[model samples]
Target chain A: MADFSYYIFCAMLLGGALVVLLSRGYVNAAMGMLCSMLGAAGLMVLMQCYFLAFVMVSVYAGSVLVLFVFVVMLIGDVKENSSIWRKIGIVGLWVVLGAFVGWVSPMLSQAAAGLSKTTEVVFLSQAKNYGLVLMTEFMLPFQIAGALLLAAMIGVMVVAKNPSRKKARRELV
Target chain B: MSYLINQTATCMPALLGTADCSYADMALFIVLKVVFALAAIIVIMCFAALSVVAERKVCAYIQGRYGPNRTAIPIIAAIPLVGNFLKKNGLMQLVADGLKFLLKEDPLPAHVSKLWYLAAPIMSLSPILICACLIPFGVWWDSGGAAHPLAAANIDVSLLAVLAIGALGVYGAIMAGWSSNSKFPYMGAIRASAQVISYELTMALAAMSVVLYMGSVSDSPLSLFEIASAQEQSWFFMTQPLAALLFIVALFAETNRLPFDMAESETDLVSGFHTEYGSFKFGLFFVGEYGHVALGSALFIILFLGAWNPLPYISYPESWGWISTLLGFITFLVKISAMIFFFIWVRWTLPRFRYDQVMALCWKCLMPLALANLVFYMAIAAI
Candidate 1:
């Protein structure tokens, strides 16, 4: 029963991701992105990463996708706004992801089968695991990501809301 | 690992007890518990609604105006033989109000995203139900006579899990307002986000103190039972009265009751986030509000009131027999009712706080007070 649900979820996920890549309409694409995110969260739950699944729902769905939708609306280029160039642009990335999932899933199951001996399901149970992993193993990358987000936020605020910059630019022009 | 297997094995007896066995069975067994938890809330909501009618009646009677007693219908009219004498003054006053809402057009203005507008109510309802699942209604016992937990989803991380689930209820309001594509919805959403997030901190901090204290109180075989048992001779509030007080206040605000009802300051924002909602969609927000009140009341009773204990008198696994369990369950329900009544009473007595005052009280009054309370508790624990 679990496996049946897993396969059905997988099908829906892939279909949604495919739609995200293929859909001409931005609305449809955004909807597809949400479906894919939801499917990923579902898979995390199935893998016994319940807390991570919930955090994914809370953070990605609640905050990140909300921002995404808000930005899409704010940008308001609402024509079935897919172009041939952008479609072709992501084919290599799609192929790579497809290849990775196809190869990794079997390897994961094989590894899981071997480790079925230990029998302790500690998958994503501890917040500290992700925190420690972020701080230690991926320290530089995480720091860099934080720096980038801060810089981007400042840049956006400056470009959009800085009155002096607008005056300075106007004077310069 | 064996524990999980053993639990699944034990569940066989439960599953075999009825083919129609369900979460509902577990849910029904908690009936007395739910009443204890929700009694005050049911009373308050009933009264809060009744007060709305009473306010109208009072206004009419005072001004020499005829109220709509003509439309009264008998819902199991209590008057003796003649059904007409027992006629309710459109006793379906609530029904009429309900039908008006149901038949009233759901005014989804062109500006709103239809999907989120529709999804908001469902979202509102889901988290409230999920929060209920973690509430310990009774107890679990093994065949060896060891006590087990009564909560549906008894994750070791249930304290934090319940908090997280409870927080999700805010999203429904947020989305309802933001997706509605109107100033009222937008303003309501902003108020909701600010209030929910603000009160959430104090609520969490207050709850966290207990969680931390629980760690100090017990190390292994640690259940909510332990938390209650730790208070066997004395409730936590006696030791941490300030924390308990902070918690209930936060609970009320967290549920968006009066005094913290800036989100639904209808005079200002027109039903706040749900101005556009009508029918069952509107009902979700309505019931969700009461549900939060119920859940908050339950948590308050559990944490501070020593759960189902009549006094902080009894201790040990042996003392918790079937009859005691039944009595404990009743005692718990009565506590919940008392808390809920207190909530309703407060609503009637106290007026709404202005948005600025609400924010100021939470940030300036509650937050600092919570920090100090935590430090005091920590100091005591250290000693």
Candidate 2:
């Protein structure tokens, strides 16, 4: 049953990614992304990392994808005219991605083989364990990531604010 | 196979009739689980349907008018006191409304995207049904006097699961609005996504405060069952009033109830995201809203109102066995009914806020308040 579920989730992940790559509509693409995220989360659950799985669903699929759909709707349905340069760029990107994957696959398979040799696989199942790891070993990296997010938020606020209005207010003063 | 069956039968004597079967125990377990889940869904859906009638009746009573007191079945209406009582309370209207939705012509508009229009209602209702599985409705005490939550799936991170599943409900509204291909619905969808996203933060933050407090008092703070069990001596509302208040307000917004129901504000937007929906499709959206309300109320009860516990400092005696479980379930139902009534009362009493005001209140007022509440609880937890 576990292996069967693993294969099913793998199919879902690949199928969803294919849909994201091939779908025309922005909404369809977003939904495809959601399906992919759910598949990944399912795999995470299968790995017994329940806390991370739920966090993935809540943070990425829930909030981020909703925002993506929101923006897509707000922008209205406009078909992107695939210019020649864009088509070329897409092909070039795919070639690079394929080459990178080709380079990494052997090493990944080797690592997996080595990992299978190890009897015990440590997995963080509890939120407290995750908290402890973040606060201790990963403290600096986590804090830096948080600060980066803060900076990005402030940047958005700054960019979103009307510069002309600010200038006008300054002139009035 | 015979040996397998014999081994299983010896361990599980309840399946004596299926003693010859190989996977009888596993099949029975799966079937029983599915049945329990279906029962939970049916109960929630029934509550949603009844709450519709309750909303109408409450609105009528408040406005000094009779609402749907005449809809009655043929033979059932001819019966004695029971029929009269049902007629007087407009209980039969539930049947009438349901049949009307089912039997009515399901119209498909030319302008709308058919696929998304079809999918939206299912998307809306399924999340609520899924979340219902995580709620610890009441406690069932075993012979050993240990308490077990009467839930479909009692997981460690059920609270997070609820929030994650609940957040996906936005897709239904967004899809409904976007697929309608109309101005009002598009606007409503925009409003819905924004409103849901904004209030979700406050809701999570508020719940986090409770979680923080629960961490100090309980073993597993993230589990709804643990949260409820921790509140056996004292309800969280007494201690975490501000978090409770914030959570309640966020709940109102998240469910798109008044005065925060800018998505479907009838005056401005005809029916908001569901403007193009008709017949059973519209009914699904209606039921989904009430289902959210029902689940949200149950969650609130679990979090702040002490779950199956009757009152503050008062708990069900484990020695009473199944009777205690029955009483606990009844108490839970009664509490949820009162919360639903409170939802209706507030809806009828308060006027809708302007969209800008709603956003402003969420960001400027509620967000900061929720953050402060979280900080306060964090400090308390630290001490």
Candidate number of the best lDDT: 2
Top model number, TM-score: 2
Supply DockQ values for each candidate: 0.13, 0.38
Taken in order, the candidates have interface RMSDs of 6.4, 6.1
Off by over 4 Å in 1: A5-44, A49-95, A101-173, B1-7, B10-75, B79-111, B140-143, B218-230, B314-320, B375-383
Q: Which ten residues in a row have the lowest lDDT in candidate 2 chain A?
A: A115-124
Total clashes for model 2: 0
Query: Considering every candidate listed, which one attains the maximal DockQ?
Result: 2
Cα displacement (Å) at residue B132, model 1: 1.4
B69 in model 1: Cα distance from truth in Å? 10
lDDT by residue for model 1 over B3-39, one digit each (tens)? 4435444443353342233565444444544554464
Error of 2 at B55 (Å): 0.5
Reference-based lDDT, each prediction? 0.68, 0.87
Please identify model 2 stretches exceeding 4 Å from their true place: A81-119, B1-22
lDDT of 2 by residue, A90-141 (tens): 6677568867987999999889878764457556777776777779878999
DockQ of model 1 vs. true complex = 0.13
Chain B TM-scores of the candidates = 0.76, 0.94
